[model samples]
Target: MRAIQITEFGGPEVLQVSDVPEPVAGDGQVLIKVDRAGINYADTHQVENSYLSKTELPLIPGGEVVGHTEDGRRVVALVGSGGYAEQAVAHAPYAWDVPEGVTDGQALALVLQGTTAWHLLKTSTHLQPGESVLVHAGAGGVGSLAVQLAKLWGAGRVIATASTEEKRKQVLDLGADAAIDGTPEGLKDRILEANGGKPVDIVLEMVGGRTFDESFAALGRFGRLVTFGAASRQSAAPIDSSRLMKGSKTIAGFWLADCFANPQLLGGPLTELFDLTAGGKLRPIVGGEYALSDVASAHEDLRARRTVGKLLLDPTR
Candidate 1:
């Protein structure tokens, strides 16, 4: 089988496509014949040694794969490694049936982002109907899904922040009540005005750095701020206790990989996410597809911010 192996961490150039032994399913695991494997910032971070765990070199960096088992059942699997190959191994318990009407690429796109969005909504924050919410990176993988979920879950005003006019329009088309430019300091004010002077009850923050403090300032009394990623590549900021004390704000962080390690807590959100997609309440946006051989280019595009929405790597290619 062919796979993209990251032998050393540096740049996308380090990702090389080479032949590797086909993976075999262990007793409690299943082998997924790879179709499309999702590419995320986590994969990029892992390759650069920025992931929470120190990664072992020569690693296959993909996480979620949409494909079939030996028996020909359509499924989405969350695997440890080898997703950037022709065949990958996944724990049986982590393999989920793909929805009947969903395409393989769509199914693959949803696994990581969908689960994260669901957990962010149902676990990280409590949004009441008629309350406003703000989501950063609103056109990116998790942001797009987060906007849809917030709307479906009955958020009265859903504000999405995007870098470009095109991305801002994309989120509006996906059901965001209002789309604002993420750059300007006026974003918080725009959100505030859109909600009729009510501060946002929940903030789904993926962009850290300057945006983090701005998000904190935009929260209403007793509001929740959920940080899922630091797309801005900024250092962690020290929390201002005075701001929390003044506004009754709460800060929470979520990492899906860590959450998955605790199944007892992850099970509910995982199952609910799948159910939402299967029922047509949530949709996955697979914006780009690339051959596995193009792994380096894919990572380059991701790092350069040249791509939008979810990216998938076709391992069979």
Candidate 2:
């Protein structure tokens, strides 16, 4: 079998396409003949050894797979590794059936980013309907889904921030009430102005550094902010406890790995996402596709921010 192996972590150049024996399913695991895999920002961090968790050497770096099993179940599953290969393995509980109409790429998107977005809203924040909401990186994988799902779940006003006009427009088309520039300068002002000159009730923040500070500052009294990523690869300074205490503001952090540890909590949202995709209500924006041999190029594009939405690799191509 062919897999993208990272013998040592550094850059995209280290991701080598090489032959390795296919992984077998363990006693409680399921073997999947991987058709496509999703390339994620976390994959980049794993390669650099800067991820929140450590990754072993000689790793096959992919997080999710959309493929088949011996019984012919077309499923989307979360794999810890070996997704960037001809075959991968997943635990049975984490492997979910892709609905009849949801395409493979869409299903693959749901396994990681989609589920993260879902849990951010449903489990972590418990967002209330009719509250104003702002989502950073609204054009990317999780942000795209967050924007749409926020509106679907009944946000009174949905605001999205993007680095490019095209991306801002992309989120608007997906149901954002307004879109704003996500630049570090005057970002809070822009978000405040976009929300009709007031602070927002909810914020979906993933970018760290100045962006995190601005998003936290843009929250209204009793506002909730969920931090999911640091795509900038930088951390924000510690929040002033006094300020949060004074304003009744709350900040929460979520890691997808935690969700993986508790699969019992995912049954509802995963089923709904598949149903929504099958019904054409929720959509995963797939932006780029690469052959398995070109995994390094995919990583290069991702690290360089040269692509948008969900990117995929066709292991069988």
RMSD of each: 1.8, 1.1
Residue-level lDDT tens digits of model 1 in 1-317: 88988778977888999888888777999988888898997788888888767889779888889888999998888897778888899888788887677778767767778778878888889777876889888888888889998999889889998888998889999999888888746666777776777788999997788788777878999899999887777855687689788888899999888776665454456567667777787777888999998888898888776677799998877
- Sequence-dependent TM-score of model 2: 0.97
Candidate 2 weakest lDDT stretch, 10 residues: 259-268
lDDT agreement of model 1 with the native: 0.83
Give the clashing residue pairs of candidate 2, or none: none
lDDT by residue for model 2 (1-317), tens:
98898889898889888899979889889999988899998889999999999988979899889999979999888888889998999889988888889998888777788888998988778888999989998988899999999999999999999888888889999999999999889999999999999999999888899999999999999999999989887789888799899789999999988867678666567788889989999988998999988888988988776677899998876
User: Where does model 2 exceed 4 Å of error?
Assistant: none
* Residue pairs in collision within model 1: none
Q: Against the true structure, whose lDDT is highest? A: 2
